[model samples]
Target chain A: MTFVIQLMSGLAVGCIYGLVAIGFSMIYRAMGLVNFAQADIMMIGAFLGYAILVAAPGIPFWLAIIGAMLGAALLGFVIERVAIRPSVARRADQVYLVLLTLGIGIVLSNGARLIWGADPVVYPTGLTHQTLTLAGYPLPAVYLYIAVVMPALLVGLHLFFTRTWLGLALRAAADDPDTAATMGVRPALATSVSFALASAIGAAAGVLYAPISYVSFDMGVIGVKAFAAAVVGTLGSIPGAVLGGFIIGLGETFGGQLIATEYQDSIAFAIMIGILLLKPTGLLSGARR
Target chain B: MESKSPAALALTGIEAGYVAGVPVLSGVDLEVREGEVVTLLGRNGAGKSTAIRVICGLLKPNAGRVELHGERIDGLEPAAIVGRGIAVVPEGRRVFGSLSVEENLLMGGFAHRRGIAPKLDLDAIYTSFPRLVERRTQLAGTLSGGEQQMVAMGRALMAKPRVLLLDEPSMGLAPMLIDAVFDMISTLAGKGLTILLVEQNASEALDVADRAYVLERGRIRREGPAERLLSDPEIRASYLGVG
Candidate 1:
């Protein structure tokens, strides 16, 4: 039962990592820039949801999640236009974008600390309080939510990429920006949309995560773990990132139980390094260089 | 080439290159009439590719105008130029390697907003390149050099372009594949597609083009019907090495 419980918690945590990893994958593929601020963006989303829940006490949790997603998406658009796009236009190197995103992350984390204080705050449990009993096993309702939501988002994203014009444009830009531009798809617009979508996904993960972990400034570390998962899965493959996240989550959970809990973070990093060393292209099949 | 309509694409006094103050193509002038296949012939660094780039809106001309059906397009973006019905099969067959062959075709149809609509049909492309149909599910990067070129051409055709610009379509292909590519270009031109073909393979280019321009150091040194240019003593001696 304890093992099952640990698996459940790990899976939930893994789903959050998967969501953020997918966001990173999308932006990286579209513009060839890793938005290092992705995790802090999630932290900001959590703080926003917490503030709204406090201010309008009767607002439903689902509504708060939606609002946070929209807010984060809007913030993503503004940041891309003002910060990222200009740097790209000026032909800055990838390292410059990395430094810029790191600065953004620092600003967001410190800003959250200023607004909400450094103390961890209790977020409403939503459905997480509910528990499920299976064949001699117990699972948190949040774990079930995570499992369902992650796969559902993956399916939706698949449909978006395959069935929609906007998604096709995004995929085309990701493939070859120059050729895509020649085919009447604006690379800049596609990249902006990618950033917005990534931010929304990050925000959704934050909302889902807050109920389980309790919102805190330190949650940004989870973003680093998610980045590790993305690297493990192959930086650009969406499905790969999700699978990598689950693997890391499972490893961390079991490692915590069987080994030292303090090493949970280290376990995720070790898996990432192992994957890189073994198959540099990642576990999923795709182009890496 | 007897259509009374304006040329499908025209460039006058176009100047462009990669670096400032050191032009690769200077004062280059060319035109392709509706349904005409015009070949741009030059040795390496003779401005064949530069002229194509300027016309395709990939690079802005340092001086002069590029017009498609009488509308100036010199300052337009590549996407906008595509919207104006020009598609380029760029040099080196830069296919989207990660995408399936079918997806690459679909991307080609991205520019054709509306028309007879069959202009950008996948069936048409597949019909033209049947080999691509059999390998539609495969990633483009995995294909052989010749097959990748076919995919690149099929992708451009998916745009249902009024003017198709092919840059070195025969590059890196085997002798048999080169013959096949030239045959396809001739067939496309026969079907009334206006084409601007840039090639270092002067003989094959002349065989397919209705008219030909010989460029040297970014300037047109000779221009005439393909047959006339092919038989010209100077062209045969200098470009064809047949004298």
Candidate 2:
């Protein structure tokens, strides 16, 4: 029973990492950009959820999550339009684009610090502490929520990408922008939509995560673990991201028993390096260079 | 040659290149009349592909004007150019490797997709290329080279384009496949689709085209009827490798 409980908690944490990693993979696949600001977008989403809850104290938790996702998506759209697009239009060097993303990440983290203050804020929901018994075993209610919500999100994303024309356009533009253009797809529009979709996914992770842990401006540091998860799973594959998240989360939980707690963060990177050394393209990757 | 139909597509004195000062296509003029099949023939670096790029709005000419039935289109974005009924089957049969064949066809119809009327029919496309019907769900990248070329052509045709620009449609294909492609081109022209074909295979290109232009060093060195050029001693020696 205790092992099962530990596994459930590990899976819950893995879900959070997977959500953020999806954003990383989406943006990376679309534009070959490793957006450092993606995790910080999660931070901003948490703050947005908090602000929304404060504004309407009686609002449902789902509504708050939606509001936060929409807010972060708008911010992502603005960032792509105001900053990323111009640099790309001018044909900036690849190194410059990478640095630009790093700089934007710094600005976002520090900007959140200024706006939300340095103190950690707790979610005002009673659901955080709520518990339920499943087959005579006690389980955190938030874990149940995470389990339901993650699968729901995965289904929604799958439908959006496969069953919709906009999704087809996004994939087409990402694969071959020049050919897509000849086929009458506007590359700029496809790119903007990709950024918005990735940001919203990140924001969903933030809202889901806030009930369990205190939301801080620097909470985005967890992004590195998610990045490792993305790389480990396969940088651009969505399923790979989710699988990577589980590996990291479960590894950390089990390794905590054998190793010092101080080395917990190092485990994810260690796994990432090990995977890369064995298979540089990643476990699920189709050998993309 | 004078025709009752105005120039369906025309490029006047187009000058363009990858580098700022060095031009690959310099002071080059070409035209395709309505329902005409015009072939541009040249050696490896004679700028045949560059001319196609200029006409399709892929590369903005440093100084030139591209026209569709007299209206300018050079400075427009490639999507806008396609929206105005010009579609190009780019070199190398660049099918979206990850997307399914049906998805690729759907993307081609994206411009006029908003209206209730289905301007482009998937069933029609599938019927035209019977081989594609069975492979509709397969990723384009996994297909053989000839199948990818069919997908590229069907994708371009999905736009219901009035003018079709084909860039080396026979490139890297088996001789049997090349004949099949030329037969398809002849059929498209029979249905009154204006075409601009760029080719290195001079004999087959001249066989399928009504008119031919020879480009050398970014200049139009020869212009005449396709059959006349086919029998010319100079063209026979330089391009056809015949005495």
Candidate 3:
């Protein structure tokens, strides 16, 4: 029973990492951008959700998720247009773009600090703190929420990318921007949409993660682990991101159980390095250049 | 034999190149009238592809005026040009390899429409290239070279373009595949589609074209009825490899 509880708990955390990693992989695929600010976007999303809850007092959790996603998407689009597009239009080097994203990340976190103050904030809901016992073992209710939500998100994303014209256009644009333009897909629009979508996903991850932990400006540090997950799954592969997330999440959980709890973070990196050294292209890498 | 139709697509005084002051196409003028197949015949590096790129808005001309059906379309983005119905099957068959063949066709019709159910357009493409029917769900990158070429052409056709530009349609194909490609071109022409074909296969191109232009070192060296160019001893020796 304890083992099963640990498994579910690991998977729940993995879902959060997977969500954030998807944003990383997607932006990388669409614009060849690393988007270091994605984690900060996630941080902003959590704050947005918290603000919405404070404003409304008792709105449903799902509504808060939607609000955060929309707010983050708008921010992401504006950031892409204002800060990123100029450098892109100039055909700046990849190193310069990476630095630009790093600067933006700093701006976002610091700006967030100015608005929300330095202290961490907690949700007012007591339901998230409730613990459920299954077979004489106590499990966090957030894990159950994650279990249901992750599958739903996966299905939604799968249908979106496979069955929608806009989704197909995004993939096409990422694959070959020049040919996609000839097919009537505006490259600028595609990049903007990609940024918006990635930021929304990042925000969703933040919302999902907030119930399990305190919402703070520095919580974006988790984004480093998610980055490790993206690299473990291959940089631009979607399914790989999810798989990488599970591996890191479960690995750390078991590693902490077997080894020392303090070494959990290092364990994630150890697994990532071991996997990269062996596969180089990641576990489920698609024809990535 | 000229039909006296107005120009469906026209390029006037186009001067363009990849690098500044090293123009690939210098003041080149060409036109494709409605329901006509106009072939641009030249050797590799003779600015044939460069002209096609300018027409499709992939490359902005240093100085030029591109017109479609009497309306100027120069300085527009490539997507805007595609929206205006000028579709190009670029030099290489640059298909979105990660996307399925059907998805690729759907992308071609992206200029003006929404929703996933553009069934009529997909049906037309599948009807034209029946081989694509079975492979619709397969990733484009997994296809053979000849099949990838078909997807590229079909993708452009999905736009229902007013004037189609084909650049090196016969490139990197087997002899038999090249013949099939030319036959498809001839078939499309018979359907009253206006076409601007760029080809190194001068003999085959001239056979299907109403008129032909021979571009030499960024200039129109010769242009006339396709039949006249086909019979020219100099053209036969230079491009047709016979006299």
Q: Candidates sorted by DockQ, descending order?
A: 3, 2, 1
Worst 10 residues of 3 chain B by lDDT: B111-120
Regions of candidate 1 where Cα sits further than 4 Å from its true position: A55-60, A125-128, A136-138, A285-289, B1-5, B113-120
Docking class of 2: medium
Query: Against the unseen true structure, what C-alpha lDDT does each candidate score?
Result: 0.87, 0.88, 0.89
Give the lDDT of residue B212 in candidate 3: 96
Q: How many backbone clashes does candidate 1 have?
A: 0
lDDT tens digits, residue span A31-62, model 3: 99998999999999999988988899888888
Mind listing the fnat for each candidate? 0.72, 0.81, 0.91
Error of 3 at B16 (Å): 1.3
Candidate 2 to native Cα RMSD, angstroms: 1.9
Position A176, candidate 1: lDDT: 84
Estimate the overall C-alpha local distance difference test score of candidate 1.
0.87
lDDT of 2 by residue, B1-243 (tens): 666556999889889998999999999999999989999999999998888888777899999889998899999998899989998888898999989888887777877788632334788888789999999999988899999999999888888899999999999999999998999999999999999999999999999999999999899999989999999999999999998
Q: What's the TM-score of every candidate structure?
A: 0.94, 0.96, 0.96
